[model samples]
Structure formats: C-alpha cells, structure tokens
Target chain A: MKKINFSAGPAILPASVLTQAAAAVENLDGSGLSILEISHRSDAFDAVLVEAEQLVRELLNVGDEYGVLFLSGGASTQFFFTAMNLLNPEETAGYLDTGSWSAKAIKEAKNFGKVNIIASSKESNYDHIPRGYTVPDGLKYVHLTSNNTIFGTQFKEWPETDAPLVADMSSDIFSRRIPLEKFGIIYAGAQKNLGPAGATLVIVRKDLLGKVNRTLPSMLDYRVHIDGGSTYNTPPVYPIYVMMLTLRWIKAQGGLEGMEKHNERKAKLLYEEIDRNPKFRGTVADDFSRSQMNVTFVCTDEADTAAFQAAAEAAGCDGITGHRSVGGFRASIYNSMPYEGVETLVRVMREFE
Target chain B: MKKINFSAGPAILPASVLTQAAAAVENLDGSGLSILEISHRSDAFDAVLVEAEQLVRELLNVGDEYGVLFLSGGASTQFFFTAMNLLNPEETAGYLDTGSWSAKAIKEAKNFGKVNIIASSKESNYDHIPRGYTVPDGLKYVHLTSNNTIFGTQFKEWPETDAPLVADMSSDIFSRRIPLEKFGIIYAGAQKNLGPAGATLVIVRKDLLGKVNRTLPSMLDYRVHIDGGSTYNTPPVYPIYVMMLTLRWIKAQGGLEGMEKHNERKAKLLYEEIDRNPKFRGTVADDFSRSQMNVTFVCTDEADTAAFQAAAEAAGCDGITGHRSVGGFRASIYNSMPYEGVETLVRVMREFE
Candidate 1:
C-alpha cells in the first residue's frame, strides 16, 4: 500500500515529482548523466537553476528588487545568517515568538543585535498567535514564523507593522499568496511544500542588504550569493534540481492560488473531523490561528492515543505522531498531499469513534 | 554509448549507488514511503545517518576522540567555520596556498584571525605543491588543501608539525587512506567520491572544540552538531542517504586500501598515456606532486584543443574540458569511474594523436 506520509518537514512531495526525480537520478532528461553526477557549473544545471528561479518569481509574484537564492544549511543556518546580514549591534529587531521556530530565530538574532519579543504565545504553550502588540518605531525589521509546525498554529492575518517584515516561512511558503512588498526577506528550508531537504529557499529584497556594519562571511552574505547567481559555490545541486521540478509541478497546478485552495480543502476536511468526532480534539486554542498545513489533535481520552496511532498506521497513515514537546498527533498535509489522504484519516477517525 | 564523465567535484559516483538511490527515491526499502518524503527524525533516516558515520569510522580508522558530522553549506561554508571555532582573533593560523580553493580558504580565514601563508605555489600557477616551508611556532592549526583540483597537484607528504592539520579534502577524500591521527579536522563536500552535492562530511576532534572564546552560533559550533549527532537541524537528507550507500559500496569493494589500489591503477593508466603520447603533456610541474584523482593535461598544439574536445565529445567523452583558469583537459577519475572508462579515454588519445 502507498503510505500516507504525514512527516512535518521532509514531508510528502507530489507523487509525480518523486517519479520524475527518480528517473532523473538515473539519467536526467536522457542527458546520459545521472543528476547526481552533473556539475553545478554545467550549462545543463545552469538551465535548471534559471528555470527554478523563474518559477519562484512567477509563483510568488516577486519583483526585480528581490533576489531568489537556493542556499544550503536549512532554515537553521538562516536563523543566524538573516540577522548577521540585516541587524547591527546597535540596532533592534522586533520578533513575534509564536512557537519553537520563532523562539529559535529570536535566539540567533540576539547574537547579532537586540531582539525584542513584541508578543509571544509561549506562556500558553503556543496554542494561539499572540495579538494586539504595538509595533515599535526604529526597529530594523519585524520577524515572524508564518506557521508553527509543532503547535499547529499559523498567523492567519499579518501583523500590522511598518518595519520591513522578515519571515522564516519554513513550513507555509508557496502554499498561499502574500503581500511580497511588505517583507524585506522570506526564507524557508526546502523540505516542506518545496522539494527535499538540503536546499534553503531565500527571497531577499536587495536594498535591505549591505546596510549592516559587520563584515559577513561569503556563504552567509546574501549579496555574495545573489551576485554569484546562487552558484556562489557548488549549491545543493540535486536538491535544487528537485526543487526546480517541484516548482514546475507547482506552476502546472496553477501556482500559489491553486495551492492555497487545494490546501484549504484538505485542512477543512481534517479540522472538521477533529471538531465533530468526540474521540478527538484539536490542539490549538484558537480556530482562526489553526494551521492549514499541519493539523494537530489528540484523543479525547489521553490513554487512547497509542491505540489510535496504531490504528492510523494500520490504515497507511505514517508520521502522524506529534512532536515530543507537543504530544498528540500532527497530520502534515503539505502542497503535494492529496485530498484523499485526508479523507482516509477522516474515515479512520469516524470508524474509531 | 554511455558518456565517460570526468567533471571535477560534483563528479562521478558509482553506477550501482545511483541505481540504488533512484530506487529508494520511489520507495525506500519497501517502506511504501519515498526516501525523499521520509522525515530526518524517523528511525529510517536515523539508521542511515548512524551507518554512514560508522562506515566513516571504519574506513578512516577514526577514534572516539573524533566526532563525525554530516553538515550542510559545503566546503565553502567550512572555510570560515573552522577558523571561527578554532582560532581566536589574537591567534594566528598557518595555511599552504596551493590553488584557487586554497586561496579562497585563506581569504575566508583572514576574516577570523591572522593567517600566515606558510608556503605558496601561486607565482608558478600552482603546478606543484610548495615544499620545505617551516611551520611557524604557536600557530592555531596548519591548514592545507590535500588536493588542488584546478592545478592538478597534491601534497605528497604532510608537513612536520605538532599543530593539528586541517585539510579540505574535497576532491580526493576516500580515494586513499590518510594519516587521520595528524589531522584535527577533515571536511569534504559530498559531490566527488562520497555521493552527491548538498551534504558536507565534517570529521572534527572533540577535544579541539570549546577552547575558542568566541560565542559561536548554534549552526557553526562543532560541539552543538556533535551533540545533535548531525541532526542539530534538518541535514541534507537525500545527499546523506546517497553518501551512506556509496560508503557501503566502498566497503564492498574492500575499504580504503582497495580504493587506493583502484585509483592508482586508473591514474597510472592515464598518466602513462599523457607522458608517452606526443599530443598530450601533463600539467603539474612536479611529477610527484601530480594528483592521482584529477589527471590534468594539455595538448602540445594549443589550436588542436577545440578539435580534440569536439572529437572526444563525439566519442562519448563528456566533461573532459579543463577548468577555465587552466585550459586543456582534466580527467577526474574519482573512485566511481570504471577502469574501462580510462581505457576508452586512452584509446581516444591514441586516435587523436
């Protein structure tokens, strides 16, 4: 049976993307060389890089002011790199601490500059997005995680902030459209809604760079990568190539607008089941902040958690176990997760009830 | 005809490894989940990471003192990271400048501390490794590029020093047995002999860390990664998985000793042809310093370069063109290049002559 993979990140990719990527690993588009063996400097891979960048622009409605870079080190590296490039020691940056990833970003930013926790839901176990915080003047940028993969919460509405918004949208990027002009930077690891792991997708507004006083390392500097066309060094080639294919897949599925609707339908189906079924309850406190990507819930009877998990696994649902910090279940239905997979989970819940 | 790929790093991998990787991409070990979709936290990938580290220990004879980490950002990132963790701003490190990569490393290292160029072959176009340079006293570490990919030169002997030797063995790692005891750090990007691009193999001495006073970011700190077991963040999953498979293949072919013999055979076959054939001349000035992995050579008649390149391509020899800095040919016969591939190249050289 085809396993319904609900892995939070490094989660399910489109079946067709996997099939095409598999073939390319052996022989990329009949080029007689495995994608694994091709040089990043080769004309063939240059085309792949170019097309992938183009697809991001088309899908995200990006402009000339922003540079699209497929980098390495995942979002974890970006946690420091963004601050290293954007924030100075004397400068202060405001961050909205929604969940685990947000807290991490804040921690790293403190290494480079002053980080103010504008608002935080951590006191409440991050079950809801904190609201009604004042956006302080003279802040370099306002940072936030668009979605909390662990807490199963998301920023349904953008915080009204005049500071150029820098987001670590590791889990929710490309799933929906956003006001691109409102942000100075948007970075994500390529495990969710993108391709596989390794490649980090960074879209940075060019003007915001070169303003920081610190001398940045070449790999961490956005300008060096932008100038090198993301070939600054041998990029994560295989991941970028897979990302190009995934982006091509995204374009074919009608871009982000299409992805938003597709994701919404799946989220609605699963969330309704969690609410309606007495056997299960949603983890997040607020309905508005509930994530469309990762649907988290727990059994009404805590002891029944293990039995329900075994039942889900038997029905081909895998990686549904929640994070250790937040114990329950989290069904991560990213862009490629078919609606039928969610339907199967809903049916399993109904049967269990 | 199957093309004989000889592109430098992001070079060839074993054909069987590629085949296995392709299959796993579709469904990993019959788990009904594509390897691309599997979580980094899953037991499936944990096993992959554990086995890969074990294989490194077995192959390199790594002791408990050394901590093997599969990191991201490639060798380019490590150029600064090593210096950041090892050298205080007051400290000085010695570096051997051999080629482009070495020079780049030197440039990055200077940002962290005082870097002394212990020896350099740059004046002579780096055609030979510098010899007889005194290892200055009180140096934090003596860094060197084990193999100069662009200039086709390699260190025939290690410099006599008590300072822990740090090597960027990007191209020649795993091609032969090394003096692992002398080195404090050994890092290689996983494009050449390992598997693919994205994941970087970092082997660091545990005792050498935490001595530096600099407050290290979580991503750059070697100790943090060691504690996380290379799972500090989501590593380049697919590349690490492919590397594990490649390492497994290496063991099957009889470890590092077996690889050294295989590489020597390939190198001897082509180097002999270059020396005897009037049409070709080896690039390295010192015969002993010539790299076994990248056998770079030039045509005696410069005008014949274009015609020879075209003819080789027609005969299914791809990626033979040399680095743009040094125009000629570079047959990068990394571990995976079959012995038959070299024989075919020899036949091509004879035909061209």
Candidate 2:
C-alpha cells in the first residue's frame, strides 16, 4: 500500500527535502562526510547556517530589522525564553489562551512575568476563538499561538493590538504567508513545517530584546544564541541541515506565497469533502473555527469512525486517527502534504459516506 | 572511499541505529505510519518512552535512588538549571573550569548563585584538568565536566569532595563505567556517545529537589521533565528515539563494561601512534588526560599538520581536524567510532612520520 501521511507536527516534509536530507546524511556536499560528521563551526556547515537564516528572511521578506536564530530546544523553550527576554518579572504580559499549546506557553510565561489572560475560550472548550478582549495598556507584549493543532482551530485573522505581538507558530508556520511585520517575535518548533524536531527557528525583531530585568542563562538567552550564530554549542547539526534543505525545497516550490495557495487548496479539498458528506460532520465550529492544517471531523455515528480510520489506513492514508482529547479524525495537512494525498483522503471520506 | 567518521558529535552514530531510524522514519512499526507523524501519546510510542528510560536505568545500574530524565534541551540548558535548582540565592556552587563548555556553564550558573572557581586549568590554556580542590563546606554542589572535548582532557579520576558532584559528561558519557554512587547528578548531552543532539540525559539523585528559593520555568524544572516522563510537552521525538537505538546498540556490543574495554583499546591505538611518531606530538598533558574520546595532538613541524589532515581525509578518516581554539589535530575516538577507523588513522599518522 502507498503511504499517505497525515500525522500532525512531524507531518509530511517535501519528498525532495527527504531525498536531499537522506543523501546528506550519507555524504554531504561530495565531501564524503556525513552531514552529522561536520562541525557546526566548519565553513561548509556555516554556509548551511547562513543560507537557512537568509532564506528565512527572504521568505518572510523581513530585512535587517529582524534577527533569525536557529536554536536548540523546541517551542516549549521559547514559551519561557520569550517572556524572560521581553518582559520584566514584575510586568504583566497579555496572553490569548486559545488551546493546549497557548495554555502551556501562558503557564510557562507566568514563571517569568505576570500574565494577564486577555481572552480565553476554555469556557466553551476552545471550539471557537474568543473575541471581545482588550489588549491591555502597559502590557509588555500580547502572546498567542497562531494555530491550535490539537483543537483544530486557528485565528482566521490576527487582532490589531498596539502591544508588540509574539507568536508560537510551531504547528502552522510556513503553511501560509502572514504579514511578518505585525509581530515582534515569531518562533516555530521545526517538527512540522520546517524539518525535524530539536531545532527551533526564532525570528525576533532586533530591538525587542534587552528589555527584561532577569539575568537569563546563556543557553536560554536569545542574545547568546544570536551572537554565537546559533553555533553556541554543537547545534542539532543534522536536523538544522535538514531544515536548511527543507527551506530550499520551500523556495523551489515558489516561496511563501505559492506555499500558502498550495496549502489552502489542500485544506479546501478535505474540508469540502467533510461538509458534503452527511455521514461525516465537521468537528470544528463552522466559519469561526477551522484549521487549514488539521481538519478534524466526526462520523454522524461515532461508532463507524474507527472503521473509517481502519479503512483509510488499509487504503494507505496513515495518521488519519484523531487526537484522543477531541475524538473522531484529524487529517494534518501540512505544507508538505501533497495535494494528491488530500485528494486520496477526500476519496476515502466520500467512499465512507 | 569508505568514510571513517570521527566527528565530535553529533558524531558517528552506529550504522545499525541509522538504518533502523531511517526505516522508522519511512515506515513506523509496519503500521504504514511514519514515526514522525504519530502522536507521542500513542501506546506504541509510550512503549518507546517506557522502554528507553528502563533501558538507560538498567544499562547504567541506576537504582530507585536516582531519577533519569530525557529532556528536550541539551546539557547546555542544565548548566544553569542545575545550579538554580540546587543552590539558594545566598548559597554558592563550586566549579572546576577545564575548558570551553565548563566555562560557558559556569557563566550561566553565575546568574543563579555565587559561583566559585574551585580550581581552573584555563590559565594553562585548558591543556589539563586541575589536580585537587577542597569543596567549600557551605557550597551546595561541586560541578565539573568529566571529559573536555574541545581541549582533549578528562579528569582521569574525580575529586574527593564532600559537596554533591555534578558531572557534564557530554562528550564521553557511556564510554566507561562510572561510579554512579559518587555523584549527585550526571548529565550528558546525547550528541556524543548516545545519539543525536537536542535531548539531555540527566541522572539526578532523588533527594536533590525543591531546594531553590525562586520559581523556575516548567521547562527548566528537572522535576517536571522527570515526573512527566520527558513528555511534559512534545519532546524531540526523533532524537530520543534514535538515542534509544544507540543505547540498544551499546547493549548489543556488550553494555558499558564492554564499551569501556572497546573504547580504551581504540584510544590506546591512536595515542600510541602520536606518542611514537617523531613528526606528531600529543597536545594534552600526559598525567591528566582523556582516553575514551577526543585526543588532540600537534605536529613537530606545525606547517605540515594541515597537509597531514588533508591526507587523513583523503584516506577516508574525517573529523581529524583539531578545534580552532586548541590549534592542533584531534581524533575524537567516540564509542561509535570503530577500532579499525582509529587503526587506519594510526597508519596515516605513521606514514606522515
């Protein structure tokens, strides 16, 4: 059976990226040296570092105003470091707690600063994005997750807040082209869109740093990672190199604008199928709540959902299984999930109906 | 040419581990699902977590007295966290400054508590480890990195100190059987001797918790990663999975005791060549030096060393280039590096002589 992956986060990467990464692991740049074998300080690997950051700037169209850092520890690390670097311990930071990831970030940020819950939909079980919350004055920054992967909901539009905006775009980054200037900092854990786990791509507006009153650890300090050129220590070399390859793949596919359109089409194919089939009902709230990446839906009869999953697996569409917290089905349609794969998923949904 | 990888980690991982990891990435557990796609919360992946922790404990002979955590951030993060967790704001921690990693670690620890340089070989250019130091009675702990990869020096034997000993054996962990009872904590970044970079292996004694006065970020809390089974949040899944395979390879090659003999033999072979060859001279001080990994040496005629490194690479022995700071050649004979590779290096060294 042909494998069509739908697993969230370490979701499908561009097949070309995989091919290049696998080849690099064996022999990088015809040096007969495995990408894993080269030092992060080496000129060859340094080029990988420089190109990755440059491409990130190019993709976002951000100029010298922002500093792109490739650092260790995933987005979870960023949840704390962002607060530690941007907000003083006594200062209050506004947070929009949309789902699990945002909650985790809010919880972590609380350790570093006083966090004000600007708005939360936990009262409604996060089915819809909360509205009607004021972006408090004197707030250090307004923090929010761009997309909630587990809940399968996203903020269709970002709020126009005067406060500097910070986002943990771990699950939905690079899937669409957003206005990069709207946020002070945007970081993504690379398991989903960029490459593998272990590496985090932190793009911070240069001037937003050095405001926090805390003495940060060197490793956790964004300035330290920035100054060290992300070679602060032997970086997660293979993963970062693979990320660079994936970024190259993104560029080859016509950069951010093309990827956004491509992702939208794939999301539409699956969402349209879910809505058309009476046997299946969309899990997320209509119009106000929908995730372009993770399309969650339930069978009208939940009993048949397992059968549908098994059938989908038998048909070679993997990771169609839904999250246990919100049961039914979730098809994670990352940037790398080919349109053909979504077409296959649509076929399965229609066949099930 | 057959590549003999001696890169100082993300160094040479076992070929078997690589093959299995590649296969897992392609197809996980014959479920037709890629390992990257599946939820870490799944029963299948949960088994990986349980078995990996169990395997490390069993391999290290860690009893109920110690808690083992596989954390997302590398040992670099722990450089501060460990101090913060153990040392009160008024208390001080003692450190032995061996080389770059230790110096970096000490710098971070200074943010949390008073840092006392109990001893340092930095004035001597980190070519050797300090001989003896009395641990301050009021100090919370005495921290030291057992093996200094950048400088090619090891403690050879640990200090006889009353204070708790914390070892960052990042480069040479699992290369020898540690007297586990002597240290309160042993942390190793998994890039060397274990698997890829990103995850840190922390072996901390059960008694050392809830001591620090200040609140720590959840990510920095060792207790969180340990109690949460290293899945407090989404872990560096691939890095930890690959590390498990590397651990399995270590066990198959006769565990740590077996690995010790294997490592000693490999180190002896290369060191013997450098000692005997008139053209090449060993860089580290003979009495206090490393054996299991990271052997640095220089040529009698320093001008010819560059040619020798080129020749070594041409001979398919890569990563023999010395650290820029050390200014000489280094053969990091990590556990995964085959004895045959070292022998090949020895042959090249003798030919140069």
True contacts kept of each: 0.85, 0.44
* All candidates: TM-score: 0.99, 0.95
Give chain B TM-scores in order. Answer: 0.99, 0.97
Cα-based lDDT for every prediction? 0.93, 0.82
Q: Which candidate is the best by DockQ?
A: 1
CAPRI grade of model 1: high
Interface RMSD of each: 0.7, 2.2
Count of backbone collisions within predicted model 2: 0
Ten residues in a row with the worst lDDT in model 2 chain B?
B31-40
Q: Report per-candidate DockQ.
A: 0.88, 0.53
- Model 2 B-chain TM: 0.97
What's the lDDT for residue B281 in model 2?
A: 87
Angstrom error of the Cα, residue B165, model 1: value is 0.2
For model 1, how does the per-residue alpha-carbon lDDT over A143-189 read when each residue is reduced to its tens digit?
99999999999988887878999998989999989999899999999
After TM-score superposition, the amount by which residue A101's alpha carbon in candidate 2 deviates from its true location, in angstroms, is 1.7
